[model samples]
Target chain A: MATGDIPQGGDTIAVIGGGLIGTSWSALFMAHGYDVVLQEPAKAAWPAVPERIATALRQIAELAPDLPAAGQLRLTTSLEDAVEKAVWVQENAPENVPLKRAIYAAVEAAAPAGAMIASSTSSLVWSELSAAMGDPARLITAHPFNPPHLMPLVELFGPDPDRLETAAAFYRGLGRTPVFLQREAVGHIANRLSSALWREAVSMVAEGIASVENIDAALVHGPGLRWSVVGAHMAYHLGGGSGGIGHYLSHLGPSQERRWQDLGNPALDRATQDKLISGVGAEARGRGIDELEAARDRALIAAQLALSGQRP
Target chain B: MATGDIPQGGDTIAVIGGGLIGTSWSALFMAHGYDVVLQEPAKAAWPAVPERIATALRQIAELAPDLPAAGQLRLTTSLEDAVEKAVWVQENAPENVPLKRAIYAAVEAAAPAGAMIASSTSSLVWSELSAAMGDPARLITAHPFNPPHLMPLVELFGPDPDRLETAAAFYRGLGRTPVFLQREAVGHIANRLSSALWREAVSMVAEGIASVENIDAALVHGPGLRWSVVGAHMAYHLGGGSGGIGHYLSHLGPSQERRWQDLGNPALDRATQDKLISGVGAEARGRGIDELEAARDRALIAAQLALSGQRP
Candidate 1:
């Protein structure tokens, strides 16, 4: 991988939206000593996103002392200005397909032809998102977890394998680990796995077998930590010890089949709805989305920065 | 939860055993300021486990400066002296039914009735383990995650309800959050959830749907982080948004049902075994059990200390 070709110096990178993710992108790029140009026409999300970004940058700066200065990010109201002459454009606009198409058209017009354009869409397929772009090959899903300034992972998915490699290099240039998904599934890699687990968790809760807190406890204290390090396969592989995954599976496989058969298949009923709402509301204790999101962002920043060392 | 009930100035809490979970228990207790009395007869394990525990404790001390002095933990060979009048006895013996029964019996004799005897058994039912004890009530499963010093959760299980409360109170006193299982199940909560996921991951790997690393990436980068806070049910609730778990269940539940039906119940074939091993081996290449363990302990300390602030 020609990591050096991704530009290490002060090349301008445009952040096309100033929402939580866009501002986080700006802070991350600036931290790596890139010149970030952030544009937010909403006028309202302005300053708020940047301010939140500032708090995150300060934490990152403290935690990662050797990291390059992240104080060079500039915010503006003009999308054209942000996109012009940039080496890379990271679009974090709203997920409305039509609006994204218009934004991509505008970005392609404003940015140089050689510049890379990546979307931060969590669910939208790259084929659909980049269809309107002049050079759709460079348009990939460079989806970072919440508070990108902190979390070290970026899920890279799209057509154009070569461009995906280039996008991966770009993120790695900024000290982010990129996992290239082989296909453009709805949830991509992380969300799909998460959706699977969440599906079972919903079934459990809806079935009245476990409460929200208990279920969360089951994960956070239990396999959650293990998953953070070794993940499922490695964990069970080690769990099998010298026997490896095969021997372990041979012994435990039937039990798993049994459990699967016995597992509850929860459905949406009046009982389930009330149980879920009451369960989550009690756990949340009625915090609004903004407050909960802000708190989650702060925590996620701390968590991702902590795991940055484990980047392989 | 009475936090101050914890001894203000104990240098060592005896940890009997030097196995994976045992070593983790030693490191965490030591990391939290109590000196650890690690009693292991296996001379090879003695040198390695303490070194591992010390490395882990130091990492915890780095992330959380408030972590008490861990320098006081000591290793010894005498099981008799290890538990003599100790404030707490954390037993990490082998998981055999007879072994647990015998160890707790000895531990009951060595320590005062008041001194807590906690087990790190993942699968053994508490009633069986505590049956031979004079005070069966004192024996409770403080089933910690592997590398206990790092993971923030301890599953508290016992036949006696009052003792379970006491065990919970004691773990809480030490800045650890304890979740009480109303009744003992085979793997407790977290492992069971993980087993379910691992079973599915194995099925996926067996079916050639995704590689091992891809599956691991999907989880750690995606729902894993989300599970750290809100857990599975809440994630679905959020995923379903205003539709709630009820709507999600009615709509997505059948799809999961379909997936469940489609799930490959392949026996642990040779190819399947090889795939799981190759996948996990590649992932575990750089990270030894010791290194990943220490990191896990540090994160655990950080999480538990953070959560301790939330307790009323």
Candidate 2:
């Protein structure tokens, strides 16, 4: 795991596709004192990146008071220019394999030999995304949660373990917790769990067992609070009382299977989709997306601060 | 809705088990200034109840100051004596149908007719638990998360909504969040969602996609934080950006379905169980169950206090 291996000749970090995720990655890099070159071909959208990043930097600053002055943020429309002087490229492109492959091929040509192109992909995996990369080992899938500047999870997976470790160490230096995948899987780890959980949550709503509002409330009030402190596995470990998860499995494993069998596999058909849309609307309580996002950011920061000592 | 309707002739709340749940519920009832008659036939456990309740009360008090001096706590070995002067009964017996049924029948025979007997059974649904009750409507399933006094969820469901409302109002007055199920479902709301999430989480471990520690860390730092603020459904809505969940469902729904299909349905075979047990052991990082529990409680309190205003 060597930061020394980073191409010193190309001293800047290139962030491709300056959308929300790219903007967030830009803020995160800047907050940690790395000069970021962000590329967005959408000329109208480029104007919002700086201010969005500034807001994110302030939010990061609130959680971390002693952050250094942000690195200089550079915007570009050309992918060639963005990766020209890149020691590392954090690509936040859309989930299109062909476009991503083209960007990677182009990046490999323009960027320094040692520069790592990390994708901010949530849905796609490494094999498909890196199939077209000239140097596949140099391309790593670094998937950050929404608002990358705030959320500290970067799911890293690539062919090179040493490179992944190096990336993980660098993220750790920035106060991020990076989890490595032994192998690639769809949605990575967290999102798979999220989808599985939401499937049942949506099922409860569609089945009329509970309302969407109540289900969400139940989560935030109950298991959500627990998860913020401990993960699902550890929660059950602790839940198994003094005997730990072994006791839980030996004693309560049967009941868990029964519940799993009973869990709904409701399709996201039109009626279910409509129910979900309206339910989310009710849960929003007339608050628009902006307001809800603000509240979520606020709560995330406060929770992270409070759990700093206890974070896994 | 009708606290006044509680049988005034019997001026105490009967807690018909002295296990962990009973102890927590006893502390909660006593913390709210209700005299509690705790009945645990095991004389060996009687002495520990007071100290356990005291510990739970202090935990509750830490989250909320200005709490009144705790009400009286009387431990009894006989269920008849415990409920003889009970206005309401909160039964926390083990999840054995015959045992719980017998307790409910005995409580009904001795206690006032208007008393609402609430069961804190997590696994058994209302129908199974209340099958033998003379007045089935009088039996409400009030399932609380572990360490009941601290975690604020109380899932309420019964035959009658009015009675459930009364229970909900009472729980609210006690600073607990009560979520009602329009209909009974196995595992209620939070636990069902919890089971769904854990199944995927365990699959990741069993499949060696990630270590137990990394999976747990991913959760605490990522979706867990988001869930603490919102919920699985609302997180997607927010993730959809300005278009909300409707946009998310329309645009990302296919990807979600793909991921869901890819989700592993691993059985908890002995080998998988062994992996989980050892995985949790590694994740515990030499912390004993007691130490882990203290950390969990500490984090839970901090998170709750931090998000008190944001709580649903």
Candidate 3:
């Protein structure tokens, strides 16, 4: 199957590091018919990669079943061997700067000159990740939300505009949503927004405004549902009554600003931490971790399907 | 069908100020087999009430098909007639303080002694709404998300704990999820969290970190999906592996705090408003308001069904 940017038969992709992110990326790449070469130095982690990849593939099948059959999976311990014939290298090594630098240095030596190098780092900026690279033009930040194969967002940002475009095209070819950041920012787009919202949520609990259960319920039933379809901007756009966002700004924006000023910024002190821990326990309702995780996954898949109009 | 708190069959419910919120409340009450009396002073709005109720009931049927067949709907221009025999009164008057006070005063004089008078005001606190009432015990805040029949959250906050419990039971009887606030706060539980998140989202777009389209996609594809299933606290709890939220706080709480500090507090000034308007126009791709609204309603209903495991 021909796809954007890739060759008619698809390209050979190197997935360095066989942890959760690495395995999920490998599954997505292979499911889209890209030959995946996964390298893990830790012998113990290598055995788990295929199992995790299989689980991820099952999920991808449910969310996007029309894609072509998966390509072959090649496992290797040698980083040099993994990148020998690859067209793209997705580095998911440990978050340590020094460790990432060493891995990139090794990839630069062995991978083809035209191969685009992307880092799945959530914390570090592109400049920091590509500092040690001899040719940093090809290195870009392509951060994905957790469970990469399911979540469609792959936030991309970097200096080289051409490589960034190529990275975006590559991700799009794999049936993913690639959002390009105009510049570097801490926590990128999603995490920054998530952290901001969570801070206020934590403050609400700490201040005795509402219980943790009610907070979560309030979100899931209210803005969270609307957000799944239209997002914040468009939600406001519709709120403006056909005049669009400009009307909303002139009328309701002041109320939003007032709420922001009143929003809490509570510290994660010992007292707050205990409150949150106990609150979550009560909300969990005796459900085990595995049960809750499965429920979340099912709910996420259901949401994706519903948004796509695949289900009634 | 007998349900909690109400009479053996169903209680006579009054829906005052038949605007959007009142009509929605009427549809929800009628669908749950409760006799509903809806009051609207504006005669022009009365003609459209039936059509709006029919639309809302259709959506409700899809989301909660187990609900009993709808009871009768009675529309009236007289506030006295509407609340005369009601066992519960949901006041949905416009957000004007004086108008709400007058409506409550009339409701207080006409409604049955045991009737629970609740305000569906999103902005005003319980005290402010009940300030003009002689008996404020039954006058509580029972704010529901827009399209009340579809969205399950009914935020209940009031000075009377027993009445709040009764309100919760009544909403639960209607197959709605009622979240009880420990105390009164502006915007209640959901809107406050929503405003906090949107403030950051707007700041990101205004600062040029990303485009409006990308910001919306970042949320709908990222945290929005997770939020549909679990709230922020549980999300962090799961992120902590087996140790729960305490471990997450001990390890990653500092990073969250740092991200919070970096979050933007952007004002909705004129320039920012223009940028957002054009951004939304570009994202809309020429879809009209009615089309977009229908799409939102469909997606919301699908998400509700998916979460309840009613869909494959």
Candidate 4:
């Protein structure tokens, strides 16, 4: 646990916080056969963590039936006991600067010297989080997609190449695709693109070009399916016919720019927000959040299972 | 063929142009039991048409095993012969306005007066194309996604509700999802959102935030997978946790706007184009367009088949 080498299977890793993301991350780690010491101060939330992680583990097991036996999970209320002998620590506290800095101070004091501390932060950047850390180089921002256990993307950014590569290798071993940023950017790669798409989506609703149901339907049935197989750049590359993306840029670049120029920049004013809430409500058709999340997880598993055997 | 009612199964539908889109449309129509009259001005494109369509049909057949017996296909060089007896004329000419206008004139001259004339034009708006048409009310822009047979989206826009409704019903009968636009937008609904997403995607690469491979990998593994099951609005809806999109807009709307503001407006300059060509080439890993397209089609079919039995 005290080795400087990258943590591998059977290594004891500390997973701090027992919220949804923490539980999901712990499930992913345990399913991959790594011992997890989960720490959470709120004893009330501790009882539900096991069943939640077990459900997530079951979902992953369905897709990958040949996984190694799960590792041991020890729950604790004391942060020091959780990170005492750990070689890696994954912190999933809420995104508050003062609160996270306090946890990091606690972790640095108790965790083993060579252990890598990773932050599962989606919105906050590494600079802001690392500014208050004792050994700033020890912490790396590893932002997993929402519902971390089901989705495979983990965006990693830090100053140390060795640590980044170590984390990248570790994630890849666990069937996660880790995308590294050369420099820190707000929202990173995937969220930026998604936000841009949603902006235009909101504008379309606000302008009444199409209803929420139609737009959502169009996406699920159309480009969204293709996106599941290829990213935006590669989609256009294939769209260029036999000529590839070069041909697309040469011939269709003007048209793409025109479309970009025409794209809307609607503000999230009260009226626009009202339209969004109502529009998505109609699209939901009375499905509650739990039902919707269940449906989404099921579809994600099925779709990934479907695409698993095929090449990307 | 001359009836004003919507075209149903066993009816003759003319699929003009023997290119990929046209041939895929023919496959979809024929697979659903509609007799097809495919017209290609160049006889050089003739011998390859049927085989291409048969391949696409086979892909669809793998997913849907209980399809009706395919309708008869009659290929001809004469435009008049192709549309003379058809009740639904689906035109797939190139995007040249004058050429499309000419084809429309000829289609109007020969096809049944009451037949719905649907244009598979992706970018061109209804007003622009309808201006020169003999019966503008008959022409509805029914733009299908690329590889139309596999993709389910068919964006429909027309002035006349009866014609639009008829087209929508016919598409629905063929197991296609037809999303109607309340007003015509330049790139319609799906493509505009896609374009917006790509602008940010391209900017990420151009600004050296990440390599194209990582950015694409992030997307395919993360948001793209979620998107395939749910659309942007609905995904955000679910992201609001138990509170739904109402809570999301109220709580996270400010951050979303901040991300949107930081989204890039990258130009497809010479240098950027070179980066794209090289980057996608690396992503392709020496596979040609044919290989990529085949892989994309296989993934699409498999993914669709996977999600077919599951509720969305």
Q: Which candidate wins on lDDT?
A: 4
Residue B1, candidate 4: alpha-carbon lDDT: 52
- Winner by TM-score between candidate 4 and candidate 1: 4
Better of 1 and 3 by DockQ: 3
Q: TM-score for every candidate vs. truth?
A: 0.73, 0.97, 0.94, 0.97
- Please give, as one word, the docking class of candidate 4: high
Which pairs clash inside model 2?
Answer: none
Q: Is candidate 2 or candidate 3 better by lDDT?
A: 2
What's the CA RMSD of model 3 in angstroms? 2.7
Predicted candidate 1 versus true structure: per-residue lDDT over A124-168, tens digit per residue: 888898777777777888888755765666888867777777877
Q: lDDT-based ranking, best first? A: 4, 2, 3, 1
Candidate 4 Cα outliers beyond 4 Å, as residue runs: A2-4, B2-4
lDDT of 4 by residue, A208-289 (tens): 9999889988888988888899888899998898998999999999889888999999999999999888988888888888
- Sorting all predicted structures by DockQ, with the top scorer first, yields 4, 2, 3, 1
List, residue by residue over B215-237, the lDDT tens digit for candidate 2: 99889888888888898888888
Return the interface RMSD of model 2: 1.3
Give per-residue CA lDDT, model 2, range A1-312, as digits (tens). 133363332257899988899998888888888888899989999778888998999999999989887788888899999989778889988888999999999998888777788998888889998887677888889999888888989999999987887788778877888998889887888888899999999899899999898999899989988898899999999888889899999999987887788888888999999999998888888989888888888888888888888654
Q: Compared to the true structure, candidate 1 yields what TM-score?
A: 0.73
Measured with C-alpha atoms, the lDDT of residue B146 in candidate 1 is 61
Predicted structure 4: lDDT:
0.90
Residue A286's lDDT within candidate 4 is 81
Rank the models by TM-score, top first: 4, 2, 3, 1
